[model samples]
Target: MSTPGRGLHGRVLDTLGPAITAGEYPAGSVLRTDELAQRFEVSRSVMREAVRVLESMHLVESRRRVGVTVLAECEWNVYDPQVIRWRLAGSERPRQLRSLTVLRSAVEPVAAGLAARLATPEQCAELTECALGMVANSRGHRLEEYLFHDVAFHRVVLTASGNEMFARLGGVVAEVLAGRTHHDVMFEDPDPAAVTLHVQVAEAVRARDAERAERLTREITEGALQELDILAP
Candidate 1:
């Protein structure tokens, strides 16, 4: 049996999510408890529970007697699933693509380096397996092979970073890849050079050559960005 809280919570989230993304409740707009409760036909307690979910996502913040207010873009949790969905749905502008690429360039190379120096043997083996699996999956058909390996490779890199904060970025990285995987750019003919680059990255990490691993990982990602035209030389 679905709990009343669960159903009411979903309705509140659905209603408020559209409003927030549509700019009906633009950043800094105050959300009133009574007004929202009446509009959604839910009790005040149920409305509060929905607001908590939004707050957790960094979409809204509660203030003493000021109620809940929409947060600025900087304050919103871009990694939040809801935020990612909204951004992709609202506008997948070139600038956003470029920004995401730039972020990956900055974070991923360091992660690779750290992984080379710190990853357990098991982690290294998993990385190699993922790379090999990718090659096999791409045989006669590229499909989503590269994308799956791409996300897995980076996820392990982050995990091997030995920093919880960096590892936490796995979700954001995965989301970015998943969002763009269906685009034509990612589905083009396989590039042997790209595949070789992945092999090189795995080898470098396996050899525990931190600098070499970092450089190779950077090259691979930068090449991808260049192919997408999201980065310029």
Candidate 2:
């Protein structure tokens, strides 16, 4: 069940965030609260809350003299899940995929190395279990379940790294995985090699083999990027 704030706020954010990212609401355009309230047929408070969320994302700013002004794309919080989802839904989705894939390739490999050195035994067990769960879900055609664990798998790796900055990337990993799955970038059946690689990476981390962990992680991420290229329409 969704909270009222999430239900309404997310709807408004989804509507406007994508519009902003897609260039429907270009920079310098002012968004009036009264107009938005009327347009969405919601209460002023709900409209204000929606705008406040967008402002926090750095996609817009409410000024004293002026209304809420859309900022340039560069000003937007690229790491925000909502912003990433909006970008993935836009015409420039391919570009977003490429950039995010590169970022994952760069960051996750290093994260895996750190996780191997710093992860607790419990974290390693969780990662191994998550990877194994992926195989079961994939075999059963439980795609949503598979994706949930897949996201969990990466999130665990990020969090296990013990570096606060690396831990922050868990959401980014979730965004890419969810966005890709939602867009049908992932097929119904999981790749056996990918699953195998995931298990290998987990085992490497468990064994404290940092070199192997990093190498296997790089392989997994690189494979994903290749798949994205193949799936690009």
Measured by TM-score, the strongest candidate is 1
Per-residue lDDT tens digits of candidate 2, residues 1-233? 11223667677776777899898988999989889988988888988999999999999999987999999989989988667767877898888878888899999999999999999999999999999888788775677898899999999999999988889878777867877777746666788899889989999999999999999999999898887773455
**Each prediction's RMSD to truth:** 3.7, 3.4
lDDT measured at residue 193 in model 2 versus the true structure, 0 to 100 = 91
lDDT of each: 0.76, 0.86
Summed backbone clashes in each candidate are 0, 0
Deviation from truth (RMSD, Å), model 1: 3.7
Runs of candidate 2 exceeding 4 Å displacement: 1-14, 41-49, 89-92, 137-142, 230-233
TM-score of each: 0.83, 0.82
In model 2, the Cα lDDT at residue 121 comes to 92
174-203 per-residue lDDT for model 1 (tens digits) = 766766666535566467776777778888
Model 1 local distance difference test score: 0.76
